[model samples]
Target: MLVINALLRGGIPFIIMGGIALLLNYQEKYSDAKSTFFASLIVFFVGAATVIYNIDHWSLTKQSVVHFLIMLITVYPILLLSGWFTIASVFDALKVFLVFVLVGVILWIVMFILAKVFSW
Candidate 1:
């Protein structure tokens, strides 16, 4: 179950990133699927490590929108580090940022609905 959550949390974002990258490729190709996938894997590792390094401090006993949003935002820069860390301009970065944000919104909705249905 833990492993699945880890995968979904990262995998869903990767799908979002890849899909957005494909769509946003209209303007000079900000990033590619390969880079997006690689970056998302890095994000998974980084996020997991952050929690595992101090498990007691970060248990998910309670879910809060603020914490979830902050974590989602944290992932954006990590994705940028892997995908657009070089000569990408702010506009290009913003494009990726917006993509993740849209995905984040969708993810939040899914999570909320799941919680409601499952009484989590």
Candidate 2:
């Protein structure tokens, strides 16, 4: 879950998809340990960068356009890596977009519920 969130926030789904492709292409030559370690490191850096950026840019008031723009910037690479640029890949793009939206909604709902329950 953290990895997925990190990938979403970092706009680095291509890195993850590429790593998966590499693993599948050379499963016999590469050990799971190496792949996992490298992937974890990449995710760590990406997640850290996202946190830093958010911390520096956060504002009390909401701006829908800014939020949308940030989301678009984060999602473009993932869309490209998922092959969403081709006519045949329109469904793929929709799927990825839905998944992202669903995950975000779920996270928000969970946070809201938890806050209510805990009085936070």
Please tell me which predicted candidate would have the highest lDDT against the true structure.
Answer: 1
Model 2 is weakest, by summed lDDT over 10 consecutive residues, at 60-69
**Residue 101 error for model 2, in Å?**
1.0
The backbone clash count of each candidate, in order, is: 0, 0
- Runs off by more than 4 Å, candidate 1: 1-65, 84-87
Off by over 4 Å in 2: 1-71, 79-87
lDDT of 2 by residue, 11-113 (tens): 5654665567577657664455344544444344445344432433566234334444455565544444533245356786676777656765575568558
Backbone clashes (count) for model 2: 0
Instruction: Score every model by TM-score.
Output: 0.44, 0.39
Q: What tens digits encode model 1's per-residue C-alpha lDDT throughout 5-119?
A: 6566666676666676666665555656556555656566444433332244554533344445556566766767764544268987878777777876686678668868997
35: Cα error in model 1, Å: 5.7
